[model samples]
Target: MRPPTVLQGAPYPYRANSLNLFRLILAGTVLVAHSFYTTGNGEGPHIRGENLGGWAVAGFFVISGFLITRSRLRTSAGEYLLHRIVRIFPAFLVCLVVTAAVFGPVAMLMQYGSLAGYATTPVTPLQFVWSNITLYMNEYSIGRTLSDLPYRSVWNGSLWTLYYEFLCYVMVWLLGALAWFRRSAVLAVLAFVAATAAHALESVINVAGLDGDFLLFLKLAPFFLGGACVHFVIERWGVNPWIGAGAFVVTGALILGVPGWGGQASAPFMAYGLLWLATVVPQPRWIAVNDVSYGFYIYAWPVQQLLALGGLGIGGGALGLIVYNVAAVLLTFVFAWLSWRLIEHPAMSRIRRRVVVPSRTGSAAA
Candidate 1:
């Protein structure tokens, strides 16, 4: 039998990849990047005007696009939406509550040394929780807490992307209904191409001083669609190591050489490179088994805010940054762990139970 090549590949085991570990690392990268920003140190690093956090968030969308596309293709629309909702909503709602009730009071106490008048404050705890409950991020702060901090009054700045992420999910779901999109690899490639072009076009628009708030959608869509494109490529041809390497080379060139549109154009290559790395890189069993990336991503900002309120960040140098990060990670990991155990996993498990489908032998299996 002939060995599988890039054009015609062998079976790839989905579980063999180390995507979970990559996710955790990306989540940590966001935390580190925010450490610089929340402390007023500036965006830590940039490649072609995109900071580390921006890159990390793009990585997140890429990964999500790939996985969520597969998920949408594999299940009914109802099941797919259910899984997405359960995966996101429960933990998010609970995080809002904890931030409002627990972190808000804690920040108030740490900053003003009193919780007096916290309830009547504009955008109170209940209001904050209720407003952002639908993932629209209607409120960013609870009471006047953290208002004086560098980042200023935001409990979780990382949350603004959730709304966009869900919007992308809906786009994919809508596209998935078309048989041409589902069956034709060409369609996936076209989607990726169109998204990348829009991203580049938006970059050009910003350079011409026509930027607006809504352009963020164009900024993020390419990466997500890039992931979706890779999924189709994998399904049709296979995971090709050589193709992946060439993609990395392209990505590096676009990122380093091009000024305005380079990063935008590199979306497909970046997605492919990450996917390739997942295949080669090994993951720790603990991390592979239990994903705390979402929890960490959601909780890190508030934990850092609380630290700043306690007067930790903003003045000191490297040592201060290290201390702040160490403390934040430890505290935030505890919250993430609890969130996974108490909220995300349990909610997902209940959804899994409800997602019963017929087995090949004419029996129902969950």
Candidate 2:
């Protein structure tokens, strides 16, 4: 079949408003969940129920699918691909390098001391280099203990999710460029299918005695699918307020364990997504302009780790840990805001200008 032509239409309302806002909110939620996990409160060592923030990574993918799909449908295939790579890759590379510089030396020092007299500690510089460059640590966690790679072991536990997000971006780009799966409706359904299938496959693999780490992708499918489903409903059908509100309520109820709570622990996220969509009717200044959600999400883990090592007792009983975590969350917001203002925004502006879209009515390019 001949390739599908790019659609020349007004930007979809849901995507222009609700989708981006929801993504920021979801990113914030993931950060909060991570803060809880890193704080070591309520969690009694053996992988407690509150690890839901990890799913935020998956939610990110779904948002990406929808947004990237929207971009692909509107812009030329080359411009679409360029936009995503420009938006994501530069910030990612900077973060990766910063993380390496901060943690690499500390790790080397610790290993040096440990093997002062004995054979050089089995430190593989190659592994550290590769892991940071490729974000491989996120694929499967290693260095589970405090003694293992003490300084750099968990340098950025969250980086793994970035890798998956990048992969999804590429997938969407190819689909758009090749004009495969051109319809938004089909893409949405396919998203749901991919998510559900991923989950089923994970469960099946686990049952068949496969390694748990290998099943990570499966566990993350639902959240991504959920986001795509949201896009499909809002953009395709043009969700009315009543229906949106009803969905908000139903998703909330489901989150509260009404009809089969497979991952009820991640209910907050589902609620967040639904409510986020419901509020897309455009109230001026509804969300804070300088929302530091990304900063909070990415930086919280490292701050928590530092707190743990500082003997300030991050894992101390409930109240103390809570307080420590709260402090970290606040600090993360500050850094995130700074990063956005200084690094991310500057880069995005420059890149966005490079792929400018010409106006339809012969107006000046946007």
Candidate 3:
């Protein structure tokens, strides 16, 4: 039940937090991409399917695959899951709480005029906690049935991917735990292939108007597999960092130019390429330090929604976006620090306490 501690009392390895830094940038990319939706621009060159934001998602998938696999390789399955939950949930709950506090009441009053049913809404503490903790809320419920309204769904739409990432974690963990794959490298390839097949099938279904739900599977699996490939290549055969970085650039360019082509298929190759560069890059003291990216990603959408509700509109073009980003950045940093200090760290410590069996028990078992 105990969560894993921070990489051995601070000063972690070189690549430890770099992917997280990349995720921060990707979160911003998603914001900008979604801004297109908010702006009512349906189709345009810069805001097309292959926009920066799409790439950002790809990056996230890759990171998840690589890191989760690495975590399993380095620790026990129980510890890996605990670390993930502790790192992810506390800040996530905080975000839900803050957003609901700032927006739920105001939106209710503005729309419903009397707050008659505010207590029953998704933003209510009970609803938010229940929906988020269970993770199946999104799948089972329709609009606002879970913890989000229709328009407000975008508030944390980025997290939809996290659900899939969680799935990926389970799959990867099972594969490793069961010794299903002869090598991590083989597992990586299988994941990529599966993801690619899923995506291609989804695209076919969408084109035929058969279904849209399949898109979810297509998007989630490949990127995750891609990340795993990167980890396998580097950790196993020891590919050159520069070669990896260059491959990443090339693959990235291809995807940007033609995003509709089974992007999930290409992500693993690209992720490994980029990861190669990550390995070669000099480890800055700052990079290896604490990561604030997850906090940024989880909180930004909710904060932006709250800001919009407050009439601090992020609609004045580039300047407005900049202002929103700055405010979100500051708030996210504070949240991350608090989460690390008060909630995540303390909870992890408690878990550790529970994990270490007493000497009497150990002697008896021995």
The full ranking of all candidates by lDDT, starting with the best, is: 1, 3, 2
lDDT of 3 by residue, 1-366 (tens): 332332112111333435545666677677656544533333223523666666777787887777777666655678777776776666666656655554455555654456665567444545655676644334222124213332344446556656666777777777777565535477668767866875666656677775544477666678887777766555544455445556667686666665555466667667766565554455556535555566666656555554454444335566665565566556656666665666666765665422332421121110
TM-score of each candidate?
Answer: 0.91, 0.70, 0.75
Error of model 3, residue 73, in angstroms: 2.4
* Number of the top-ranking candidate, with TM-score as the measure: 1
Best of the two (1, 2) by lDDT: 1
Query: Which lDDT values do the candidates have, in the order given?
Result: 0.82, 0.51, 0.58
Residue lDDT tens for model 1, 182-219:
88667777877876676667756678775564578777
Report lDDT (Cα) of residue 32, candidate 2.
55
The model with the greater lDDT, 2 or 3, is 3
Residue pairs in clash, model 3: 226-268, 244-273
- Model 2, range 229-343, lDDT digits (tens) per residue? 4554444444355544464466555545542234422422353355345356453353445434455456666665555555444546667766765676676666667667777
Better of 1 and 2 by TM-score: 1
Residue 51 of model 3: what lDDT?
A: 65
